[model samples]
Target: MPFGDFQKSSKDIQLLSEHILAAECEVPGSGYNHSEMDLDNCLGDDNGNFQWGGRNFHSHAHNIIFHPDEGVAHVPVLRADLDGGSKQSNVNLGERIGNVNGHLVFRW
Candidate 1:
């Protein structure tokens, strides 16, 4: 199978974001960019404000970012593997993205 086959497209991701952020999803979230780290929950955001955490299962790269920077007209996904798949690296990545949207949007 092609590696790209497993990759998530911008549209797919957008829908996923919408689904995940939906109030009816039953998953409590801190909006798009707002995040809070909790040891119990295994989420490490350092209290900066991150909406979600993404990890490349194959590469072990950690990614955590906020709302897409619509104003910037670009979508950015911060990936960190400096610590060798360390969960804390995800938190660092989120801090870099800050609270903003990118080019990718649900409506194209």
Candidate 2:
């Protein structure tokens, strides 16, 4: 999938911000531009409150582990050696295992 596919939509982002505010968590703000890392804007403003943006997102080192639904396979299976016909032998292992609604998993 494309990198942009991973990013949530503007509507989804708005909803998330609203939800966070309602839950009494740190308020979201456009602290820094995504294309340009505005360090000056972030460091200068110190409300003692919490804030997050691309500056932290891009600077921070973090690992994301994507877990598919229970009993759902992540990747397809293919035989390296072509003993049998390529088209006939190759099978999608996930199809046999279970189905995962990607929309539901990634949707807001």
Candidate 3:
């Protein structure tokens, strides 16, 4: 497959996973507990965000990716789950320092 097609397909799969995660919840009287669903393993936290390509993504949910029309080539993301749950945060983008050891690095 061509690279663009492969990339698009990959994004489609990711989007599907995000949908499944969003629709997942405890079903009352269904004899299945939330733990039984094992959805926690697929998420990094309660925000339904997951880690991929060394960045945080939420598909159609809250995420840190700068879109092409945003005019910014990249934006640094820093996530913190204060109050033991996901909350809105103000972030500042730092200088990109490229990748290191399979990890994306930035200079603050």
What's the TM-score of each model vs. the native? 0.19, 0.16, 0.19
Model 3 stretches with alpha carbons more than 4 Å out: 1-14, 19-43, 46-71, 74-83, 86-108
lDDT of 2 by residue, 6-95 (tens): 122111211111111001111135322212112212211112211222122112211212222222433322211122222222222123
Q: Please, what are the lDDT tens digits per residue for candidate 1 over residues 6-91?
A: 11222222213212211111112432332222211222233332224432222332343333322243442333333333343322
Predictions in order: lDDT: 0.26, 0.20, 0.26
Superposed model 1: Cα runs more than 4 Å off: 1-59, 85-108
Model 1 C-alpha RMSD vs. true structure (Å) is: 13.6
Task: Give the C-alpha lDDT of model 1.
Answer: 0.26
Better of 1 and 3 by lDDT: 3
What lDDT would candidate 2 get against the real structure? Answer: 0.20
